[model samples]
Target: MADSDMGELAPSSSMDRRDPDLYIEDGNIVLSAKDNENNTVYFRVHKSTLVKNSPEAFGNMFSVPTPPNMDQYDGVPLVQMPDDAKSLRDFLTILYDPQCIATILKAEDFPKMLRPVELARKYQVDWICKLVASQLQSSWPDSLFQWNIVAREEGDIRAWDAYRTEAPEGDMDEPRGLRCLPEPVSSIILARQCDVPAILPVAFLHLLRFPSEIYDYNEVFPWQIPERSLLSQQDWARLVLARERITRWFTQEGPQPWKDCGTSGMQCQVITLTTWLNIAQEVAVDGNILKLYGRQVKGDICDKCKQKLEDRFYHLSVQFFRNLKHFFQLDE
Candidate 1:
């Protein structure tokens, strides 16, 4: 708890019992929300802690106004939150638990932090939003080499390894963020909603690597309602342009056989180039590039040629990403 003995809400609500998971036996305030199962979940917490974390959101609410019209159950004031019980629980976990943020930062699943982030923004809780944004911003690779690695490694890479994934675990300069969730398109939609702009470019790129089947049907995503309206017109346009640009890059000026190969035969270079070109073409058409390929190169090619190939690919990929950003008016 950030603050203690600061103030208290009305006590002992028979109608508002303490939540076993969130109740700090002697805490001052009780927060409650209805769960999906239609049960009221209560949280016993300190008003001071909430106030300290989000002054604009909670401070005024907790204060004694000129004429207080408070909501109470069984004599104890109850704060009604708009979020579902699960999201509220996760939001509180981030606020109170020291290890929760660390867990969120490292989790392979992006949805783990999605609900919490939504609640944070809904309530105008700036700190949590900023924390999430920071994690997301740090996840993007700054250098060409790093970007290349991320393009190949995709979701499994650390947010920062050499700012990509292979960097030492102890490195502190780059923290990671959640990878594309549901799919890259969904992840971009989530990012746009959350106001995290840095994630857009890479997310768009990842989305390009998939098939339209993932985005064409509204039922595929749980969010869309009666209308089939997931992506915006601009988003669809960006996807089309990105595909055209990448297709041209692959077919017209694809990776050439690197001359650095020594022990590995030229046949291996051909296979690797062919694979890379295929992925580019597939990505343009919304094909499953990931399913067709994995990170492992095995012993098929020599290390030097592989490095050269990746380096070359990195140059073209970065250029394509920049061009795509321009097409979407996201470069700014």
Candidate 2:
């Protein structure tokens, strides 16, 4: 049947009904009221008309129960629709109906469906994650399986390394943080904490590796190093070079101005350390070492040195794992 024809027969009372207690006033549906001898007669105009014309008012008026005569009724609590219940009903109804389900199943626009799936994947609840997984399993099983395997393996490696390094010396009995959880679990934790879309692979990499290096390398690097340890020596060296390049960029052009001085030397040092720590944390969390290090000092000269801080500083910092390593070593 045609959509309009199908719409005509739908069971929505508001769609079929007319405004009963309202009248047209200046082309607008408005409530009509009369003051009786000792009471107020309050009645709505064409409620359905109001609903169609002024949905906000229509929603407000019929939202609760009232005495038969509007005049007889004193002010009372407005009727309210239970949003959660309505949502549950709508979801279940749409999900269970064969026609609706089939229509969704036949939809060729995968990207449109991707939005909701991504939302479900980001939901904090485990059941929601499972529901998303199940949907993916039924619709795009292969991709879902691949994501699961990769996420799980990566999650496991991260968890093991984190446990070995960050887990307190005598506190093995405590529950693991999100880092040690399954990928989906870790993703949910991160999504909840950060309030973002489903954690992409790159984002996962950043979260797992970069931020720790920024904050306290001695504490976080040991865990990340294990993942690098598996790489061939050549690959490791290349990775180090890439990291150096990024670190140089971050120091030079990153949001924090390294040259700015607060009132006290200690305060300046604290601010610098804290800023670098935060940058490192973000880089680690995103799992993109290159991004963490990619930021370069912005202007031509180090505001302090007046001489151009050469691009070579980028590689040098990586070699020493310190900012402005060349200047400091020369000073010493």
Candidate 3:
């Protein structure tokens, strides 16, 4: 009933130091930070827009009669929010404008997207949570090339090329012929947090490329990682162990020379074979056998062994991927 009895509230901070992009001059509600230095950080947003996206949460808020002598800034109702200003602003910004995160595949601000997910889940805003989750999920497909192929097969060729062409350009080296989440680690964190299972294998596979130190570090990650976004010990173990098993299997499969047909004297060169092995290992780590075969088929193999080797590699990879579910314990 009193401030002294309510215990310590979490400290408030802003997502942006300067004015947040969402601060409208004539808005209906004021989401004030819990701290005393109030207007230093706040959001001015329309009540109807918030209510539309989050009917249950906002409906309940408006249903209750206004309390006496409640704080109001410039005739707008001031609602105290325990969330830091930045997260609240980002969440409200998306609610006011649905397209805020639509075209951006890479995480311009991962936590900006993630905060909405946390808040959406907290407030039982399923649509808002699903919007953020889908945005996060779009970064990683079940199979990158397979994703394109499926799109094309489904008669959406335009979307296939658009997604392919939309690859984020920068110093980041993405998987060959595949689209990847801008920040795999952050996406993995979001996937687990939101219970978006379809994207987990891809996220975990991409994380294998990172060094072990990246997981638990306190410093800011490149993807704007939220504070203490560590995976459970079981998940970390599962990812690491899966990477090792996949790598080992591919390496062993790599060195074997292809079977010969007497008519054609085509043989893989030692260096070329090594490169093929490396590509196989990469594809296995990436969780796509078809991509591995696609890369291999592009090489200079003679006609006699081409189809045979392709069949062999396909069977091996499919078998491996089948076992992968067991390795990752996906069945459970």
lDDT tens readout by residue for model 2, 1-332 = 11332221221233322223221233222222222222212222234433443345345666666544332111221122222222322232332242543454343222223333333333222333344333333332123234344445555555556786776777765334322212222332333333433332222333334432343334323222222222345534534454554445555543333444323544444544465566655543342433322344442233342212233334433433333223212112
Which stretches in model 3 have alpha-carbon errors above 4 Å? 1-25, 34-40, 105-112, 133-139, 143-182, 193-195, 210-234, 248-291, 294-310
The lDDT ranking, best first, is: 1, 3, 2
Q: What C-alpha lDDT values do all the predictions have?
A: 0.59, 0.35, 0.58
Candidates 1 and 3 compared: the better one by TM-score is 3
lDDT (10s digit) by residue, model 3, range 130-177: 665777666555654554463333333334444545666653443334
Q: Which of candidates 1 and 2 reaches a greater TM-score?
A: 1
Question: Lowest-scoring 10 consecutive residues by lDDT in candidate 2?
Answer: 72-81
Assess candidate 3 and give its TM-score to the true structure: 0.61
TM-score of each predicted structure versus truth: 0.59, 0.21, 0.61
Indicate the residue-level lDDT of 201 in model 3: 63
Query: Over 4 Å off in model 1, which ranges?
Result: 1-18, 66-69, 151-190, 193-195, 211-241, 244-283, 286-315, 327-332
The TM-score ranking, best first, is 3, 1, 2
